[model samples]
Target chain A: MNAIEIKNLNKSYQNGLKALENINLSVKKGEIFALLGPNGAGKSTLINIICGITKKSSGQIRVFGRDNEADYKKTRSMIGLVPQEIATDSFERVINTLRFSRGLFNKPSSDRYLDSVLNSLELSHKKSNQIRTLSGGMKRRVMIAKALSHEPNILFLDEPTAGVDVALRKTLWSYLNNLKKQGVTIFLTTHYIEEAENIADRIGVINNGKIIIIEYKKKLLKKFGEKKLIFTINRKNKSINTINSIIKKYELKQKGNKITFNYTQNSKKDPASDLLSELNKRSIRFQDLEIKKNNLEEIFINLVQK
Target chain B: MNIRGIKAIYNFEMSRTFRTITQSIASPVLSTILYFIVFGSAIGSRINDIDGLNYSSFLVPGLVMLTILNQSISNSSFGIYFPKFSGTIYEILSAPISPFEITCGYVLAAASKSVLVGIIILATSSFFIELSIIHPFWMIFLLILISLTFSLFGFIIGIWADDFQKIQLIPSFIITPLTFLGGSFYSINMLPEFWQKVSYFNPIVYLVSAFRWSFYGNSDVNIKISIFAIFFFLGLCLVLISMIFRSGYKIKT
Candidate 1:
């Protein structure tokens, strides 16, 4: 069964703003799904709805085939959420906060489990430290530790590494991957595409309160990922007229010294190879040649812009 | 019922109380003792006995009730308000715990602390004044009821308040004054016939009267009306809390 299934989810604020519309999604158990969106794209709203923090205006949500609202106690107990904001009881000790979270989720006290979680996060030494005494990055890690204290099957991280340093972010990503290997289903929303690229098995793009695409990370890269071929001609002004026919035929873009052609990975024809051989046949000398494949960031930008 | 969840919140709140022991326990207890020294001695020296009871002894129940009302509201208000203010409320709201369980956790903790303070005040008051409870069971019952009622009211205030000023607004401007004028130190019969009728308008008068009845059995108003008033206020707070949770008031969304 899917870990989370959202059907026709809609949320409208009292201020007449529509936050989410017709959101239909399902996250398979034991998979890592990353949600990518710009600010105010309803990513957090969707997570909040599923977590039962924000009440949905209309729709049905099911967790493991049980209705989320009707079986909220069971559903919420199974899911853990690390919110975007680093808000915790500053006066509370790190260990006490985790204990409180576990108890709040109706989990039995397991100091061994909590200590393991802290050790994994490298927070064992700071267990007795008050949250306010920790650095910003340490505090973020504390939030993650608190979320995992209940040993939930499903975890939702909303922009987990928004302002975190690169080193801590990488550490967190590795920890999340470790959680995934334990058969935990992870759902995360992030503006950092690199984090998603490195960790997410599937990616969902949301724009303007609507989901534009949801596909396997590999499939998305193959489908929308573009490969650009650039050729730097030996003499641009002299070769322009000679290569004008070829450039027009292949729809290439000409700059001061180079002509570039773009194609997707799944293209039927080998346009880059054909263009190279065609240029050689015509004896068009070039100084440099380069092929570049677009990463998830570029594809994400294109999709959102569209 | 999510008993563990309720316990987690209850323990969290109680720990906070102990952590700030000076403000939570010492301050109130000391203030109540000071009230005894000033009001009990200074004023008791001037006034004769009313209804055949010494002025200091007569002031015991009213003093305890005053402490319960103030402490209950302050404790419960700060308990919920700090969470909402700090953004930690998301954990509580998103947890498996129901609204009823959440209310029980906070209200019970607040009432427990208030009752402890009331008991402490009674213990200390015995050192100075000759005191007796005409109905010990009724006194205990009224103590718990008043604490729960005011704690619920304070929970509403915590949810309603957006800033610290608003949190202090009701207790300082409304509740404290009402308690002082509600006959905490003096019986309403001492006032003129018109003033006695006016005192009925203050709900604190009913609470004080009923609580005092449990002590000297010298109630200024009927016990039944006071009982009804307590339940009515408790019900109103409950209804408002239900509405707040339903509407996702300040705590959610």
Candidate 2:
């Protein structure tokens, strides 16, 4: 069974503003799904609704074949959420807070499991220290530890790396990788395409409360990634006629002494090597040669812009 | 239904009380003692007695009630408001715990703290003034009742308020003033007949009168009426709390 299934989800505010319009998506078990969106996108609203923090205007959400509202207790018990905000009671000691949260779910007190969670997050040493005394990164990790203290099967990270330093971000990346290996399905929403590109098995793009596209990361790259070849020719005006011919043949663009060609990986052999040989025969002595493929950011921009 | 959920929330809230011992317990206890020193002794030396009781002794129940009212409102309001301000409330909202359980956890913790503060203030008053609660059972009942009621009120104010200033506005401007004028320091009989009727409009007057009656077996208001007022306010606060949760007020997304 899929870890989560959402159907025809719609959320409209009291002011008659539609925050989510018929959002339908599913996350496979033991797979990492990254939801990429802009600032005002409905990423958070959808996550919050699934987590039972926000009510849906009209929709059906099922986790493990159980209706979210009908079996809220069982559903909530199986999922953990790492919110985007760094929120913890400053004065309370870290260990005590985690224990209390574990108890909240009516889970039996298992210090062994709690300790393992803390150790995994690198927070075991600071367990007895007050949360306020910890740095921002530590506190964020504590939030993660608290969420995991209950030992849920599925975890939802709502912009987990937001405002985090590079080091913590890398740590969190490996830690999440470990969770995925343990068969924990991860549903992540993030603005950082690089983070998603690094971790997400499948990418879902949402824009203005609509799910624009959802596809495998590799497939998305293969389909939308535009490969570019550029060369700098010393003599621009001399090569104008040859450059025009190449532009017509390969659909390239020229700016000053630079010529750019776009191609796909679908072609056999090297698509740009023949063009390179052609340029050599024409005596366009270009020293600077570069090949660039469109990153996830470009793909994301192209999808959202379209 | 989720008793463990309620317990977790309750214990977490109560831990904050011990963590900030000075702010939560000591400050109020010390202030209550100072109230006795200034109002009980300094003013007692001038006026002989009121309602056939020593002035210092007569202030005991009123002072205890005053502390409970302030403590109950302040504790519960801050208990919920701090989480909302810091954004930790999302965890509670997302949990399997129902809204009723959430309210039970926070309101119970706040009430218990207020009750403890009331008991401590009562013990403190006994040091300087010779006292006897003629109806000890009634006194305990009223203490718990007032604490629970005001704590719920504080919870409402916490959810109603959107910012720091508003959290403190009602308790300072409305509750404290009403308590002071509700015959905390003196009998309402000292005022004219019209003022006595005006004092009846304040809910604190009924609480103080009922509590004072349990102390001396005499009160400005009838015992039955006082009991009715407490239950009435308690019922209203409970309904308001349920409505607040249903409406998904400031706490929900």
Candidate 3:
């Protein structure tokens, strides 16, 4: 069964701003789905609506084939959310807060499970310490622990690394991977392209409240990433108009003496060698050449720009 | 139905109160004691009797009711507003718990603290004043009712307020001044007819009068009207809170 399915989702704020329009998505069980977007691109709104923290203007959302609203307790119990903010200010000990969060779902007390969560998150040593005294990173971990305490099968981390340091980001990356290894389905939203590129099995690009692209990470990379060959020919008496016309059919860019042409690597034929041979036939000499492929960052920018 | 959810929230809020015991409980009780010192001792000498009760003794119910109003609104408002400000309210909103369950947890904890402080001040006031009670059951009922009602009102204020300064706005500007003029320290009969009629407009006057009536079996207004006034405010607060949850005001989206 799919972990979550949202169809025809629409959210219009009372101020007449339409935050999301016609969003449909299906996240498979045990797969890490990354919703990539710019700020205010409806990423947080989508997650909030799914978790029932915000109301949707209209939509159908089902978790594991059951209506999300109809079975709020059952659906919410199956999911956990780590919000974007480091909002843990409860003056209680870390362990008590975790226990209390677990009990909020009516889960029976199990010290073993609690200890393991604490230990995995490296929070066991601070179990007895009050939450207000902990550092920022530790407080974020406690937020994650609170989300995990109830043992939800699906976890949503909203911009988990927004303001965190690189070291803590790495730690969280590995921790999330470990959770995925244990067969938990994870859904995370991030504005960082590399973050989604590194951890997501599937990446969905959202722009201006619309899902512009959603595909397997590898497929998206293969489709969007194309190789480009640029020739830095010696500045000479070559007719610029002729050169441009010669390569008019090929997707190309020209700046001074350097001319670049892009070709799909997966294409049946190599366009670079043909272009080079074509240049040679025209007696156009090149001083140097280099090949470039569209990285995930480039692809992300192109998609968002569109 | 969300008993576990209610317990977790209740426990968390209650622990916070315990942690800030000096601020939440001690400060107000200590302040009430100072009021007892100045008003009870210094003022009692000038006016020996009012409403057929000694001035010092007459101040008991009024002082307790005043403490209840101040602390109940302050505690409950700060309790809920802090979570909203820190963004931890998302946890409560996202949980499987219903809005009613959340209300029960926060409002009950606030009421408990205010009522506890009220009782403690009354205990402290007994050492200085010669106390008398005509209707003990009625007194206890009025005490619990006021705390619960005002705590709920504070909850509404907490939700309505979005900023740090706004949390203190109602309590400092509206409540404190109204309580002072609500016949807490003196009988309205001592005021001229115009001022007495003005005192009747203050909602807190009904609470203090009914509480004093339980002690001396004498009230400025009819006792039934006082009970009705409390319930009326309680119902209004409850309705406002219910609307807040139902419409997701300042909370959901």
Q: RMSD in angstroms, all models? A: 1.7, 2.9, 3.6
lDDT of 1 by residue, A1-306 (tens): 899999999999989999999999999999999999999999999999999888898999999899988999999999999999999999999999999999999999999999999999999999999999999999999999989999999999999998999999999999998999999999999999998899999999999899999999999998998999987888744566668898888899988777889976455877778888988888888999899989999999999999
Query: Chain B TM-score, candidate 3?
Result: 0.97
lDDT of each: 0.92, 0.90, 0.88
- lDDT minimum window of 10 residues, candidate 2 chain B: B39-48
Candidate 3, residue A268: lDDT: 77
Q: A51 in model 1: Cα distance from truth in Å?
A: 0.8
**Real interface contacts reproduced by model 2, as a fraction:** 0.68
Q: Rank the candidates by lDDT, best first.
A: 1, 2, 3
DockQ of model 1, rounded to 2 decimals = 0.84
Best by lDDT: 1
State model 1's lDDT: 0.92
DockQ: which candidate is best?
Answer: 1
Which of the two, 2 or 3, has more lDDT?
A: 2
Give the TM-scores of the predictions, in the order they appear: 0.97, 0.92, 0.90
* Candidate 2 per-residue lDDT over residues A120-219, each given as its tens digit: 9988899999999999889889988888888888999999989899989999999999999999999999999999999999999999999999999999
Error of 1 at B235 (Å): 2.4
DockQ for candidate 2:
0.61
lDDT of 3 by residue, A182-256 (tens): 989999999777788889999999988899999999999989887889888767847666577666867678888
* Backbone clashes, candidate 1: 0
TM-score of 3: 0.90
